[model samples]
Target: MLGLWIAVIALVGPFAAKLADVQHDKVTDYLPASADSTQVAKIEEKLPGGETTEMVLVYHRDGGLSAVDWETAAGQVAEITRQHELIGGAPKGIPSKDGTTLMYPVASNEPGANEEQRDKLVNDVREVAQGEGGLSVDVGGTGALATDSGAVYDSLGGPLLYTTVAVVAVLLILIYRSPVLWLVPLVVAGIADYMSMGVAYGLNQAFGTTVSGQSSGVMTILVFGAGTDYALLLVSRYREELRRIERPYEAMVAALRGCGPAVLASSGTVAAGLLCLLAADLNSSRGMGPLGTIGVLCALIAMLTLLPAILVLVGRRVFWPLVPAFGSTPKQRRSLFSAMGSSAGRRPLTVLASGAVLLGALALGSLNLPGPLKQEDSFVNKPEAVVAMETLAKAYPGRGSQPIDVITPQGRADETLAAVLGTPGVDSAEKGRTGDGWTEISVFAKSAPQSAGETATIKSLRDELKGSYVGGDSAQQIDLEVTNARDTKIVVPLVLVSVMLILIGLLRSLVAPLLLVVAVVAVWGASLGIGGLVFEPLVGLKGTDPGLGLLSFVFLVALGVDYGIFLMHRMREESLAGAEPATAALTALRTTGGVIASAGLVLAATFAVLTNMGLVQLVQLGFVIAVGVLLDTFLVRTYLVTSASVALGRKVWWPGVLSREPGPAEPAGSSGPAEPPRQPESLRAP
Candidate 1:
């Protein structure tokens, strides 16, 4: 098995290394294909220069701009015009009303659709447009912002991987306490991550799947987080089995057979939830579905196959200091989980009510969440492009800083230009390029980019100009927000229904599935509510990412349910063994509680690493998922779910065989059979 894995890794390693090469962070890549902005972007790429690279140069002084500063700005603009193939003509300076800032709009077609060349153009312009001691000069526009954002995205690969690995390694060490034992799962998870990357890259190539920085980064997180979770569950079960079975190989097989159903069900739920993203209208959301599934499935395969192979090969000694001696029973003591279960059993209603109220309170914070994030505010730290945009916003408060692109058929170009110029909020309109039966018109609004007035203007243009498409950075942002809202309404329900069905199939009980779904949904709401409180006030984030709610819900529900599965599956096993409902509930909690807690810590910690990322969206996402997982682990799964089960007793599995009273033939404390009875068909591992 080891040799087979080694060969597979060698074959896929090159493809994995090349995954970064195909990733794209273009504005259109994230927009829905059916959106007007997306249509405009596609048509523009087929125009004279393929795609125009637009930028704005802002030269400003604290007090006021002098003649020299004006001259310097003009000279730099002239230099830029001479060095590159500009689209319109030499840019004319547009001074601020207060005379504190002078701006020149620059556009070039030389770089076209090549991101590398476009980045070089922006950098070259920045080098030439330097500011002196009293003057501040910055390049701000869609092109420059894309370059800066792409740089951040590109840098995420190595650092994000290293940081995730380091975080998971530390957690594993603490959880295992055995110095060498932690290395086995950690190594296997890393291998799983590499395998996932290869598979993701293949999906991109074979099916032309969209590979964005956000999707790829999320894929890496799932590979490590979900992979480690599977490892923790399997290892914990292996340790328990080792005490009973003599041969190391036989013990490993028994362990797999014992815990395999729960592990498979857990991963299956996550994959199904993620795949629901395919129904979303947004491109980025849709792309994340398959990539995320690839990560989870890869991790599942590695943990089940390669991990067991290695543990068996290394023999029982692999456990080292805390090795479980064959035929020896573990020490008996009152553990923390036992105490927790006892408390819940004593006052089930009180515990359940308190947890519900706490979650409800946390969910109220969602009302405080800020508005949708603007492009300039997406970064955690202010980049050059963001600084320029901020300066422009303050300097030119009466007009938009970004251009609004209007694409129309060449035959109707004159009519469309006239209609755009007559729009209510339009400041100016000019015809630029005409090719491939399409004509491009650049329109500027009287309000700031992504502002309410600008959005209204874009909508008005779309309403009036039936054949023309209005698009640009601001329009794209509008499209993205609308698409995200639409996706949320569609995808959320699909995720809920899909996940609920999976749970029902696994547990074979309607009530059990409903309970798990409700718990996870509560976790999602509370997590987002926490984000609303922290994002604007505590973290100083200006706005929330549009897709934050939907993505976080999917993750928290899918990932959070894993613990519930681990706990409830064990409860079902005990009940099947003829134990009373209450006894089975407490027993399951006692046996699986510690492992679930460890697994939760590892999953939450892996996501928390994203908080250190450069993007505000990533930070918000990381915070919400990490907090949600912790809440699920310590509160919902441990206390509320357990209490509810103890309170409900047999009805928790309503309509199932376990829900009924045991027959007279089956004694209360009698062992049902010498060997455990086979699991029901629905309960068997896939």
Candidate 2:
């Protein structure tokens, strides 16, 4: 098995890094599939130039434009026209009424639909349109913004993966305390990550799955986070089994038998939950569904197969300084969880109530959260394009720097132009390139771009020119927000239903599954609330991502239930072996709590690595998931759920065989509550 895995790794390793090259990060790649903007983008590709890259070169002075500034601008414009294809004959400068700002609209098909080429063109324009002293020049438009956004996504591939690995490595070293033991899982996780990337690339080739930077980055995270989680559980169990079993192979088999179902069920639940994103109308969210599932499944496969084979080959000595010797009992020490369990056992109701209050308080922070983040404000660090937009917004008030593109039938060009000019809030309308059956009309709004007035103008244009399609950065943003809202209404319910059903199937008890679901939902709210409180004050994020609530909810609920499965599965095991309810719950905690905590720390840290990324959206997603996992790990799973179980006793498993069976009698030798019974050797089934 080890030899076979080694061969497989050799074959697939080379293709893994290639996944970064094929990633698509264009704005249109993330737009809603059925949105009018998406249709316009598609049709624009088939036009005369494949797809025009539009930009506006803004030249400004604090007081006013001098003759020298005007001369410089005109010379640069001439050079630009000489070097690049301009839509019209000579570039016409539209001077602001204040005479302080002049913007020249530049269009070219040279960049086509390639983001890299588009960025090159934007950069080239910036190189030529330079200013010194009082005059300032900036290149700002949909094309420039797309280039900047693409740069952020491009950074995600190498830096994001390396940072995640480094973070996970540090956490694992601290948790394991053994250099050799930590390397095994980390290596296996790396392999898993590579395999996921290769598979994701294949999916893109086969099914045309959209591979955005967000989706791909998320895939890498799950591989490390979820794969490490599986590793921790398996390794902990394997060590325990090694002390009891003689042969390493047999010990591994016993370990897999003990915790394999829990790991499988946990990964299954996460994959299923992510797959629910397929129902989303937003292209990015929908594409993330399958890519995320692929990541989880790949991690599961690597951990279950390659990890076990490698560990078995290395034998017990691989543990090195902390090696477990056969026939020897592990040193017993009082665990923090033992104390936590005892406290919960003593006051289940009080503990539960206190936890509820804390979560509720945290949830209130959501009220303080800012509004939805605008495209211009989406980056953690300001890009040149954003700076340009800001400069233009301040300099040219009540005027649009970017034109709203209207694609109409060529035969109705005159009527469409008239209707566009007559649209409320439109500052100017002009005929653009024509190809096939479509004629492009450029409409400039009187209001500042991305402002409410501009938004209203866009809506009015769409309403009046029903036959023509209105699309630009502003229109696409409108579509994104609307689609995300609609998607939330549809996908949230589907995710909830799917997750609840999975929990029920795994636990075989509706109440327990429902309990886990509710707890996770509360955790999601509380985590987001914490983000609301800190995002602006601590991180300086202007606003939250529109899809933040729904995405965080799905991730928190699905991944949070993972630890629940680990704990509840153990609780069920004890109960089936004739252990009383409270004793069973406490004993499960004492045995599994440490591993769950370790898994949680690893998962949390891996996601927190995303907080170091450049995009505000990624940072927010990472923070919420990290906080949510921590809450579920240390508080919800360890305290509240356990307390609820202790309080409910055997009734926790109502309608199950364990609940209906006769309770075990008290121990003959003990006066206090009897210790939870372990499964009899003869009764243990693999």
RMSD after CA superposition, every candidate: 2.6, 3.5
Summarize candidate 2's per-residue lDDT along 72-181 as a digit string, tens digits.
99999999988887778567998878888888888888635466677788899999999998888988888888888888888888898899899888988887788788
The TM-score of predicted model 1 comes to: 0.97
Error of 1 at 242 (Å): 1.2
TM-score for each model = 0.97, 0.95
Q: Rate the local accuracy (lDDT) of all candidates.
A: 0.89, 0.86
Q: Write the per-residue lDDT of candidate 1 for residues 1-686, one digit (tens) a residue.
A: 99999998999999999998999988777998799999999998889867888999999998999999988888989988888887777988999989999998998877355688889999999989999979999998988998999999998888899999999999988888888989999899899989988999999999998999989899989989999999988888788778878998988888898889989999999999999999988888999999999999999999999999999999888888889998897788888888999998889999999999999999999999999998988999889999999999999986888999999999999999999999899999999889999999999999998899999999999999998898999899899888898999999999999888888888878888899999999999899899999999998999999989999999999999999998899888888876778887888888888888888898999999899999999999999999999999989988999999999998999877777777666632234634444432111110
Candidate 2 versus truth, CA RMSD in Å, comes to: 3.5
